[model samples]
Target chain A: MKAVYKRELNSYLNNPMGYVFLGIFVLFFSVIFCYINLYSLVSSNISYTFSYMIYAMLVLMPLLTMRLMSEEKAQKTDQLLLTAPVKASSIILGKFFAAMTLVLLALVFTLPHIVILVIQGNPGFLVTLLAYIGFILYSSVYVSIGIFISSLTENQVISAVLTFAIFMGLLALEILFVPGIQSPTLYKILSGISFASRYSDFSMGVFNLTSLVYYASAAFLFLFFTVRVTEKRRWA
Target chain B: MIEISNLTKSFGKHKVLDNITFRVGEGEVLGFLGANGAGKSTTMNIITGYLSSNEGKVLINGINILEEPEKAKKLIGYLPEQPPLYLNMTVSEYLDFVYQLKGIKLNEKAEKGEKSEKQQHIEEICEMCGITGVYKRLIGNLSKGYRQRVGLAQALIGNPEVLILDEPTVGLDPVQIIEIRNLIRELGKKHTVILSSHILSEVSAICEKVIIIHNGRIAAASVTDKLIKEFQDSNRLRLTAEGDAQELVKTVSVIYGVDSVEIDETKTNSSAAEIIIRTSKDVRGPIMSRLVEKNIGVINFGLDTVSLEDIFLKYVGGESDEGSIQERAE
Candidate 1:
């Protein structure tokens, strides 16, 4: 398992995919920081930068997850992993972690914003930290989304489009969770499923256990589902 | 050692493989021979734990691939129909990644101030595959033959007890084919090798036991010599001589064990004829002495040859409508 993880991580580094993803990601944060943090005379709410950073991930997460499994299936390279002396969970987790690491690498670039705020003026330390947690949670869901869509097709373009559609749908589901609907009980249940509710809670510095469990379990459920999908393919 | 028993695989309503069984002993070379789409790839996939067979099992050294895939897989290395490689990585990096994926706990094997043992293994594999010169080059930039060599090198790494290669030399040049064949022959001394190819000549030349598959069924399986002798044209003797070709033909007919005779149509002369003697017996010894006493000018002689290609075509190609008609009548 360590062997697969090491190799997967190094391939991402050597392939320059890590660089491209990090480059575009840092560029998003910088552009946001310049407009919100640099141009503005008053700099109190720097944590809001991450809310804008969500748009960056809307484009970057698809790029990160697009080639993850689809390329392996396309090149037949998955055979190596499938035939290797390792558990299937290890291979899937190894990929998920590598992609998560790339997103985390992008998340770290926002740290300098907090540092600049500390030097120039006082900012809420807890809110900025909450935003980082939210960033990781949201990207984790995206990783799972990317992997599930990737397993469905061999074409990278199709995988990317499908992942984007899934992310957009999940985002829209959060907005349309009207309390006036038939049953308020079902509305609460449906709202918990939305990634927006999960991330918004974290970004607001309220670490609700339901939101935490929802985000973590949603990622786990999707990863487990992706594994089952790929495993089922061998028979189909 | 590898054992495949009663292996049956079906794709929905289409039965692609039907109760196929074979075994490979250590230090032996086994070849799977068939026409295109003979389920060769499917069989390899099942054995390597890449695909699950619906009604069969593959055991590698007593470990069932389905039940304990990781343990069974550790005993085998498989090169599928296409070399599974990350085109983005260099040759060395790709091998390193493969080595790492195999999980070598070699902290003790690493030397100080040098690359890890994984890197060393990758370098050695690159050297063995003759890709040392291009070790730093991306796999995408390499030619087809180089890609194949890289695939073989991956299979050879970790020194597994069994190597399963599907059409390893499919699109290679003659020299590359011979080189890959020689490598397999060398690897045969220490490991069990099972390679599949539609080309009958390669299987005949490189393998000891040949399994000919047709329509997803085992059509023929035996030693090469036995198969040829059992199916192809009957053995015949050839003798070229200068004489009255008609009388030469008639005289040889009277000899015991002589099945048939024919005179060469490209005549040497009108008065004296050049002839070919065909006999059931490979009797060049007694026939040559008798012919020498008759003053017949002895020229050339040998036994008729049957290539594996001939047998392969007859087996798989027999699925044609005309053959089915003939089979129905029989």
Candidate 2:
């Protein structure tokens, strides 16, 4: 596991895709940070930045996770991992952590925004910490989904496009809103599945345990599916 | 030691391996010879625990691969047909990844109690494989032969007891082919090596035993020399007579052991022509005496033994029936 993690992490750090992801992430984040805090000085909150960054994540997560498993398959390098003494679960988790580490690295670069807010308007550090934590959890779910999609195909473009389509559909659930349903039970279920609704509590300074658990569960479910998909491919 | 019993595998409805079974003893080099799409790689994949067999058990030194893959896989090092390399990594980094994947360092910490020793051991392997000079070069930049050596070095990591190589010398030059064959021979002294190749001479040159797979079935499996002997055509004797070749062949065909006779018109030297006689047993005494009785002076005489090329073509060309899969009765 340690070996796979180091190799995968180095691949990202030493390759061009890692810098591209960071560039796009930093550029969009700066644009959002400027519009929210610099252009509109009325708001001193940094959580608003986290809220808008989720939109940036929809684009960034696919780039981070698209090649994670698909490249291994396309290059036939998975034979090394699969035939090694290590289990399939370890390989999947190693890749998951490697990709998550890069996403967190990109998140760490956004710390200046919080520092600027703290210096000028004195935003509470605890609220900022909770919002960042919430954002990490939310991004992890998407990372898991992206990797899961990567395992289904050997083509990186197909993996990226599929991940983008799925994430966009999820994002649309929040942006476009669900069609009006006559039943309150169906309405509650639809709203319950909306990531935007759950993340709204964190952006509004309300620390919601249910939303945290829901995000964790979703991440676990996607990771589980990824492992299963990889294992099933052996038989295939 | 490896034992595969009644293995069967299928991709959907298409069977890739059908009841195939074979074994390699410890420290023996077993060569798998087959045509393209003849289930050689599929069998290797199943034995390496990379693919699951639909039916049967693969036991590695008594431990079942399917039941305990982690433990079984620890004993086997596999080099697939393509080498399975990461192009972005340097040769050293690639080997480090393989070493880690094999978990040899962790095992060394528990079993050997030394870190410097492991480094030295890895360096020695690189030197042995002749890749020490390219250690820092990226695998992508290396030539095909270097890439193959890197692949070999990766498989040598962890000092596995069994090495499974699929077409290990397929793309190498003649010099590299001989070098790799010599290396495989050297490795066979301490490891059980199962290599698959379509090259007949490569197998006959290195392998102690050979398995010929055809159409998802084991068409023939025996000691290399024994298979060659089994496929030997009827004993053939070539003799150049100083007299009429046609009269000598007619006289040789009358012998008790002789089955048929043919005169080589192209091999005539002056008036003497080469006569090829097919017989069931050694007919040299009878043919010589008969020639003496007929006053046909023999210029040269020799027994022609069957070459491995004949045996390989006989099996791979599907001329030998499937019933020949039964072990030869010495």
Q: Please give, for residues B296-327, the per-residue lDDT of candidate 1 as tens digits.
A: 77666566556788788777765654654454
Clash totals, every prediction: 0, 0
What DockQ does each prediction reach against the true complex? 0.69, 0.86
Single out the weakest 10-residue window by summed lDDT for candidate 2 chain B: B321-330
Would you give me the overall lDDT of model 2? 0.87
Query: In candidate 1, which residue pairs get closer than 3 Å at backbone N, Cα or C atoms, i.e. clash?
Result: none
Give per-residue CA lDDT, model 2, range B185-241, as digits (tens): 999999999999988899999999999888789988999999887766548888888
Residue A43 in candidate 2 has what lDDT?
68
Span of ten consecutive residues with least summed lDDT in model 1 chain B: B321-330
- The fraction of reference interface contacts (C-alpha pairs within 8 A across chains A and B) present in each candidate is 0.90, 0.87
Query: How do all models score by TM-score?
Result: 0.88, 0.91
lDDT of each: 0.80, 0.87
